[model samples]
Target: MAKNTSGRGQRELRVKVKTARGRKLSSTLWLERQLNDPYVQRAKREGYRGRAAFKIEEIDDKFRFLVPGARVVDLGCAPGGWLQIAVPRINALGEKSGKRMGRIIGIDLQEVEPVPGAEIHVLDFLEDDADDKVKGWLDGKADLVMSDMAAASSGHKQTDHLRIMALCEAAAYFAFDVLEEGGTFVAKVLAGGAEGDLQKVLKQKFTKVAYMKPGASRSDSSEKFVVATGFRG
Candidate 1:
C-alpha cells in the first residue's frame, strides 16, 4: 500500500482502471504501475515538475556534487525537474560561498516553463548551432555538465541500448568541450553498459569515473548514471 505523505490522499489517489475495450495488456499494466508508484505520489505532492528530480537529488546526496554557485549545464532538461533541484542547491552557499557559484543553464528540444532562477533555452543539444547558444548563455565554462537524455525506444533491447549510448557519447563530447578543469560530467546510460571506446575516453579525461543507480530509479529499470569527476581539461 502506498502512503500519501502529502495528506491529500484523495488528490493523489489514481483511479484503478481495469483493462477495458481495446487497451492492450502492456499499456494497462504500465498505467497501473505508474498509478501505484510512491515517487510519483511524492512528486505530485511536492509540486516538482517531474519525478525525475529525485534521481538527481539522490545522486547528488551520495556524490556531494552540485556545490554552491556552481556553473552547471543540463542537457535534455525538459520539464525542468533537475533545474528545480539545481537552483536552490547552487544558491544556498550565497556570495563568496565557494569555488563555484550557482549558475544553472538548461537546454532541451521541448519547451519548459521558466524556473525562477535558471536560464533555459529550447533547442536540441545535437544541433551544430546549439553549442554556441548555450555558450552565449553561459558566458564562460561550466563546472558541471549533466544529461538525462535517452533515445526513443525501439522495443528491441539491444537497439534501444545502442541508441541511448549514442546520445550519452554525444553528451560527453559536449561536456569535454565546455567543462572547466576539475569539473564533473554525468549522463544516463543503459544496463547494457557504456560502449568500450566511450568508457576509455571518459577514463582518460577524468580522475574518477563510476556508475551509479539512485534509489529513485525503479529497481526493475535498466537505467543507470555514469559520473565522471575531476575533469582534466
Candidate 2:
C-alpha cells in the first residue's frame, strides 16, 4: 500500500478479502498494482487529471516534440489530462512578448471539465458527423494531432487489439485531413504494431513514422504510441 505523504495525512487503508470469496486473480492483481504504483500516488498529490499525463510527459521529453505555440489537437482527450500538460507549455511561451499564441482543441465522447485556454467538444470521433464538428472547431489546420483513444476492453485480447487499431486508423485518417504540411500526428496503439495498411499509408504521407513506448507506461501493458511527423499535406 502507498502512503499519502503530502502533509494531508491521508492514511492508506487496506480492506480484508476472504480467500473463498471468488474474486478473480486478475482483479486482485490489478488492485494490488494500483495500490503500489508510485506514479498513481504522485498524480494524486500533483492534482493531475489522470496518471496518463506522465506518459505524454515522458514521450515529449524524449522526442523534443510538442513545441511551445504549436497548434495541437487532442483526440479522445477525456478528463483533459493531456490538455493539462500542453496548455501550460504553450502558455509559458506566450508569456514572452511577440511569440505566437498557441491553440489546443480537445474532443471526446465523454464530457470533460473545462481546462483553462483549451476548447473542448463532446462527440464521438467515430460518428459520421464527427469530422465536420472537429473541422469547425479547428478553424484552421493543426500543427499536431494526438489521440489517446482506447476501445473498452472486452477481456478478449484479439478483439480489443482490433478495436484499438480501428480507432487508431480512424484517427490517422482524420489527422491526414486536418494536419498542415510538415505537421505531426501521435496516437496510442497496441503491441501488435499498427495495422500494416495504416503503417503503409502513414509512411506515404509523412517523412517519419515511428513507434514509441514511454517509460511511464507499465511494462506489462501492451499500449504504445505511433508518431508520424512532417506530414506532406
Q: Which predicted model would earn the best lDDT?
A: 1
- In model 2, which range of ten residues has the least summed lDDT? 11-20
The candidate maximizing TM-score is: 1
Summarize candidate 2's per-residue lDDT along 1-233 as a digit string, tens digits.
98767756465555444334677877777777776777777788898887798888887877666777788889989888899888876663366467667888898877899988889888777677776677677777888999888999999988998999999999998887778899999999897744788889999999999989987788888999988889999
Candidate 2: TM-score? Answer: 0.85
lDDT string for model 1 (1-233, tens) is 98878778565566686998999999999889877888887899998977799999999998877878788999999888999888888883354454455888989888889998788888878787776777778888889999989899889999999999999999999998889999999999988854777889999999999989998899998999999999999
The lDDT, on a scale of 0 to 1, for candidate 1 is 0.87
Candidate 2 backbone collisions, by pair? none
